[model samples]
Target: MAHDALRDELATLTTEAADAALDDIDLVPTLEAARRMNAADRSVPAAIEPCLPAVAEAADRIAAAFARGGRLVYVGAGTPGRLGVLDASECPPTFGTDPSQVVGVIAGGDVALTTAVEGAEDDEAAAVHDLDALGLTADDVVVGISASGRTPYVLAAIREARRRSATTVSVACNAGSAAGRLADIAIDVVVGPEFIAGSTRLKAGTAQKLVCNMLTTLAMVRRHKTYGNRMVDVRATNEKLVARAFSLVQDVTGAPDAEVSAALEACDGEVKTAIAMLLTGVSADVARSRLAEADGSLRAVL
Candidate 1:
């Protein structure tokens, strides 16, 4: 894109506009500046409220894809790209999903996560290459995240994803986004101008993170990754999480510490199986069979 054309495009986006109200932000005291930024951040959730239905719909589509042995792939640039990676990385430890189950692709690849890659977001062909490397399939769901909704890389990624018959979702902080038009599901949270003009890493970044949280969290919940409010599928990889698992098992079964420890050991520290064994007085093998029969839903088995 030419500089003139790009400038014209940016002029039309609400997110790119400068807020005259914040022109004096730098002149204010440090505390006042922080307050102003916090106040700006607080509006992000309300802006997203109107987009919940769209978010829920996208999440359900993601859950359906997962059930079909598909994956949830997030594609974006810059801060949005980093947010996608962060969300995808948390899935394994949080919900016991394979690393391949949730994927994140940035315009410039892994190196971009730490350092900026100049003009990478404008290379639309790179976006197609990244998705192709994933062996894009019809069963997968791809989400394009771009604050301006006009990002060339994200637009290309969404288009490529749709071309492959994969479910496509667009998440942006602007109305009438190009990405939104290309996606099957459009989630646009129009939060207006940012605290710092044209810097989307602030309000836009926060909003994207929150939206991604809902997408991944609810999708896992729908797939029986949790047993009610507890993370029954949590991978106890560390001391804190192992502790959490023990407390979670005991809390759900009302079992004594010794009994919970025994059940956990018997079930190989699998929270759902341990809870099942303790609550029903069943052996670990029987509990595992029951859980499998119940489609991994503890509530159903109970």
Candidate 2:
């Protein structure tokens, strides 16, 4: 009976449906198979186009929460869980956000990220425990991701988030998913069936990745994490990043390389401060003060 119930839920999800067109994919030439796969991948973007309005709304909600000193949390299982973790982990280096500002909670904890924990996705109680550990609040935004839209762990997390009055957004590859029903905003990409039947790590994963990108990237933009298209808040932690920081400062200020280097050094390699100092001919201390006054908006400072 338990197996029957789970099978029924999966039956209703388009992500689990088999594609007859690719039935003989394994028998095809390597190049032909690759071409077919690439062709199918192209449809993911189109599937997400209609959901942009919902994605925008969710991003706005998240940005508002950030302004109010809130955090963004993603919860999921399997491939969706890894995607959430990837996005959350990237916030710091890409946008210079605090690690705590964005976080990912996967079923079975960090151990589930690499090695699949047996039955982890079915552990609803564990989901509740994980969300509780975060101390979810009304100011936080919780995004629940599941390719099937019915992962038990993800549904439980969304329910717990709702109970805490946190904003809940669901990303599902199927329309009218269980997770979607529980969220305040539902982003259903509905990318049809996958080439490899139930292997959602393909098309469904691609759709989820695109949606996650828009949510965090747009939220950061709203928070003044960039100066125009340039990622001015990027953390210059390595040699390549350090060079990119210098390049960004020079590009934005159009200052000589020597002046850019001097400003970056004076500002301790803070890209935004270096840009501000060069553009305004101010001392590093003055540039830092102006940035703080403008709420860290380089545009506003200039």
TM-score of each: 0.98, 0.98
Global lDDT of model 2: 0.94
RMSD of each: 1.0, 0.9
Q: How many backbone clashes does candidate 1 have?
A: 0
* Cα TM-score of candidate 1: 0.98
Separately for all candidates shown, the number of backbone clashes (residues 3 or more apart, or on different chains) is 0, 0
Put down candidate 2 lDDT per residue, 15-47, tens digits, no spaces. Answer: 889889999999999999999999999999999
lDDT of 1 by residue, 20-55 (tens): 999999999989999998898999999999999999
Clashing pairs in 1: none
Q: Alpha-carbon error at 64 in model 2, in Å?
A: 0.9
Whole-model alpha-carbon lDDT for candidate 1 = 0.94
